[model samples]
Target chain A: MVQPGSIVGGLLGFLGKLGASVYFLGEILRQSGIGIARPRLVVEQIHNAGVLSLVIIMTSGLFVGMVLGLQGVDALSRLRQEDILGASVALVLLKELGPVVTALLFAGRAGTALASEIGLMRATDQLSAMEVMAIDPVRRIVAPRFLGGAISLPLLTGVFNVVGILGAWFIGVYVLGVDNGAFWSQMQEYVDPEDIWEGIFKSAAFGVAASLIAVFEGYNAVPTAEGVGLATTRTVVTTSIVILMLDYVITAALL
Target chain B: MDNLIEIKNLHFKRADRPIFAGLDLDIPRGKVTAIMGPSGTGKTTLLRMITGQLRAGQGSVRIADGDGMTDIGTLDRDAIYRLRRRMGMLFQNSALLTDLDVFENVAFPLREITDLPDRLIRPIVLMKLEAVGLRGAAGLMPSELSGGMGRRVAMARALVMDPELLLYDEPFSGLDPISLGVILRLIRETNDVLGLTSIVVSHDVEEIARLADYCYVIAEGRAIAHGPPAELARSESDLVRQFMAGAADGPVPFHYPAGDFARDLAGD
Candidate 1:
């Protein structure tokens, strides 16, 4: 009933895609039940989606933390509160930058890989061949990749959080000559367990969201070269937007 | 039950164009059948319908399983998967999993569907690879394979499940003459030795004549001719004759439909 080239038509098309994506997520979760039983499949995918992405995540995390250290010192030194650099950097990273930035990096790094791999499989008739063999591709091919991404993102975020803190500590305590004990002590004191828990929860949510979008875009990608390219592009853009939006909603709700 | 698959009044359309309109055909058990047609004539589409990858828009595509004839359109997703286990298809592109090496590719269905241990799987995989004359290439990845070797490996994989029915989509499209002969022999030998019914969709008129027991030439969504390969070659219908002879001008014109050449040349 929706008319083409009209405002309502565009809205309906978007809603239709959103609805299909949600349904695709449900299918992935359902197939994950089967995928989990075969741990090797999921584990192999974890290596592909998670292990392969470590270099970028860690590298970006270190740089982001160093930047935060320099910026935090510059801004707080004006108020003569530079001694509290440890507390502020730790708070910002653990509460916000850690999960959000890691997810953004993960999308660019791992998400695109998942999309392109699955998209190419479709383009090459590999998925259809699986179907012909009575193998459910959602179970065999997609769910493992989705679960791998979901599991790996939080773990990767954890790595980012640790490496980021180390980078900040190196900059603030060693280079800036802040009292080392004060840096460690204040970070431990002011950074509550809730802050760590919030970061963990946000990261886990982002991981699931980002992974779902990636595999969803891939499994449903049109079977062509241009189609696969576009699907890969959509995965990065959609995952980034969704992660940022979820960050706001999750932080607001948790706060 | 003599016929393994029966399609009646099979109507399918892609957007506004009809792909199969009231197409009826029967594939006999324990024989090689060829669905031959020129490009874009829905020969592959018909194969998809029979395999339940696609459904008939109106009419029925029925496959005779143990219970009885089951209409593909009536089956749900799980039902279709269950049905597909008894069917094997060799895709036009070979469709080998790029991640797996040649050995693993042939062993893929067994590993996915059966719990056979490596000890048993090893010999079985090697045997299928041996059948395809590629046992030496088992460890090589798909990227390393030539077009012919890839097709052979795929054929081995298609036969791995010991399926009752096998479908091949354009199996001889791109191959050297020697490779083509190897595949041609493999199709005939496997069909007979395994007691498997095969439906090969291809346009290789000479090749189909040498291999197929029966042939169906489809056009404009219907079977325009059906009989033995020799009988089809002798058909009087202009369309069938054009296809059989590979004629450039006949019912199917050499020149695409256009305005008057003289008028167009003068920029009318």
Candidate 2:
């Protein structure tokens, strides 16, 4: 029932609104006095957004590491490059795969949730209520989530990196009969501090992009059930696209 | 009394569609002014414009006087926030935060705006809740509340800041007679107790007639009638007469489809 042109127009409109909101947020933070600078909101958001995504990330990490290990062993065994297995796994986890995959999962799960919650609030006028009471919804609501996702993504990516490496090591050393010490030493030789930094930087950017897209979609949601659904769909699609695009750009620049 | 809120030559548009143009009105301090209008007549837009939620294209909305007065049009977003701190609004559908229980909902603005300790916030939230006769409902989520109860919780939350200006958008809608009486009494009592300036937007003529010290009839994006309710009740205008009498016929058509009416007439 909806046209593709309108959908594209809506997306552009959302981006424009988000740009305006970012400007608005900067103004709000500039003018807010010391009294309302409660760090508890951000702390709460970090806990909510970060800690809540842990189980999913951990589960996905373990399986992804196992699958990558299986595929790496299969391909490397054929090429007689099993000696470089650990370095390959570590490089993939730290450079291109771990942060990107985790971000995609987060965009699907937490990003969708954030959009729906915010969209519902917008639809119901809770944001307007906050404005009327002199409370900045951005400060109280969006900033917390934005900063939370920004902080949490890197932390979660680190968790994913660590867990994924361990899972891959377990698969390589035990399941595939690869030497544990040799595998670890290869990883130590090839993995650099820059690799970790690159992954973390990517995660942080992805987090911000995803959370911002979600919040923007939610804030601009039309006041209807159908609007909420559309906002949720847009949030997921936009966040996923942005995450993938940013991953490519960041990787291209950093590598 | 000096005007609490003054709008001068207000103009607004959305996506190039004209919402209002050259609108002017004055709301006296410490009085309840009811704005009545048909749907799409810019009643809610006027409220939003005055509250700084929507900026006017070419007019000024000034609230209070001297130190308290703030120009709604000129203030930046942050300044508008500070201005909003001195005001409260009860939305048509209550708009209570679903994630929060009644107590937390009432305490939200305080928690966000002030560094008040939990001990202090507790009593303030309870006091506001008590004022709304929802003291017992403080632990309930918004999902558990009836329409009237949710409105009261929203009122409680709105009053937690003890705002100087109170705005109500369709406060009487979806309320039972008893609940309506209670809400009306509470609005009047709270305004008097706080010495608050109140602005109500409502289509309920009887309620507006009973409650408003001054009533403004907005039709077709302009103020068609403005005065005391008694004065407007005596007006000879067809719009006012039809609106006040709740008639289906007058200057306003129901806007039902012609084909549907034609089919009904054929059946008859």
Candidate 3:
């Protein structure tokens, strides 16, 4: 007895939920004023959600840069233009990998944690308890996390790009024996500041999308053990998908 | 006696089922009123409506918060928060924040709702904990404490604001006999000492009959009966008779409604 009407209704329900989530994000931004009231909570969340993601971002970034250098040297050496190894690696990371990959990692690491924390709070009645105690859970609990993510993503991407460049430099100059002058000049000449700024904007936008999705899932999660688990999983999956889709759209528009 | 809370023609539903319909109830000022019912009988919903956590479909829930009776059914978010300061509710399972130690758990309301310094906040938290006979357990984290200790700390937290109306939602649900007795005594003593109106929602007949000054028995979203505790126990209503006597057979069915069990199992 599955009606076509029911299918349409389900779609409407989903759209309604999307609208509500966007409204919730607006509230988060409005209440905290970008964490102006409670800088301490913002800093704590940055330490938890943003700063903690650093080690992995840097490690992955370095390895990816090295792999790109090795592969670029292999291919370009065959063409006898291997002197531009640094240019290839830097262009690849700056234009695409730096923001996109860091965002995906951020989604998995910080996003799931934020959702589960809020979901558990709901299950334990802490949010209702806060409400009854005259405290706004949004202002007290959610706003800071949003601010942390927004501030941290650009900084994290910067670290990733820096470490990645260094790793590529090692492979290009010392390991592969590409001319040092050629590699440096090629990287500086090809990779513009605009390219780096594009990556920053993209990662910062991804931070907003990911953190908002995480908190929204947690705040509205069904109050149970299974519910919290599902919410956490949804935070990672949904944020990752949104990041990838946004990456494509941003690349299309910017480039 | 003045009525502290007044409900008029409450209508509420959940999960496509009616829970409360055209119901009216009242809470007397400075006296304990017990809302007794079987599980899933909307007692908690009533508490939620009173707190403005749950809205009514077609009625008003009014609470006397000093200046006048504010219609909680229609108060906005900020207004509700201000009104909440005059009320305290002790939830089942304590709901103590796990991140904070016992002292901070109790002191949380004061810390968040006011700008009091740590020096002044510390003694008030300790004093409230002393009231609940848990002053020594202040340093213990929520997980480190026993169930009774946790419940006591929650009670301390609920009372730290010196609220006018206190609500307890099955406060003794998981307690052992000793803990239950301690909680019962604490509720009675604290209600009297603080001169606060209190509501206790429970189906534990014997203990509630001892603890409550007045009682209301509800079933299927209707008030089956209500009176002084002793009088309520002697009610002639069929549900009351069965409930008070703890009889196995009653209007409240022992089994859920469904098709023939054997036939369904055999897929006949």
Order of quality (lDDT): 1, 3, 2
Candidate 2: residue B128 lDDT (0-100):
92
Q: Kindly list the per-residue Cα lDDT of model 3 for residues B1-268, writing each as its tens digit.
A: 5899988878888987999877778899989999998889899889988887889888888988676887898899878888888888888878888889998899888987888999999999999998989898899999998788788898899999989888898988878899999999999999999999999999899999899998888887777788998997778888998888788778987878889999999999
| Candidate 3 stretches greater than 4 Å from native | A1-10
Tally clashing residue pairs in candidate 2: 0
Q: lDDT of all predictions, in order shown? A: 0.91, 0.85, 0.87
- For model 1, report DockQ: 0.85
Better of 2 and 3 by lDDT: 3
**All candidates in order of TM-score, best leading:** 1, 3, 2
Instruction: Report the lDDT tens digits of candidate 3 across residue range A206-228.
Output: 88898899899999999999999
Q: What is the clash count for each candidate, in the order shown?
A: 0, 0, 0
Per-candidate TM-scores read 0.96, 0.90, 0.96
Candidate 3 at A255: error in angstroms? 2.0
In Å, residue B130's CA in model 1 sits off its true spot by 1.3
Error of 1 at B8 (Å): 0.3
lDDT of 1 by residue, A1-255 (tens): 645668878888879988998898888788888664789988998898889999999999898888888888889889988878889988998889999999999999899999999999999999999999999899999889989999998899889988888888888778887778888898888999999999999999999999999888888899999999999999999899999999999989988
Pairs clashing in candidate 3?
A: none
Model 2 per-residue lDDT tens digits across residues A1-255: 899999999999878876886775574345434224666777787787789999999988888888878888889999987767899998899888888898888888888888888889988999888888877777677777777777788888889988888888788889998888888888889888988888878888887777777777787789789999999999888778878888889888876
Model 1 chain A: lowest-lDDT 10 consecutive positions: A1-10
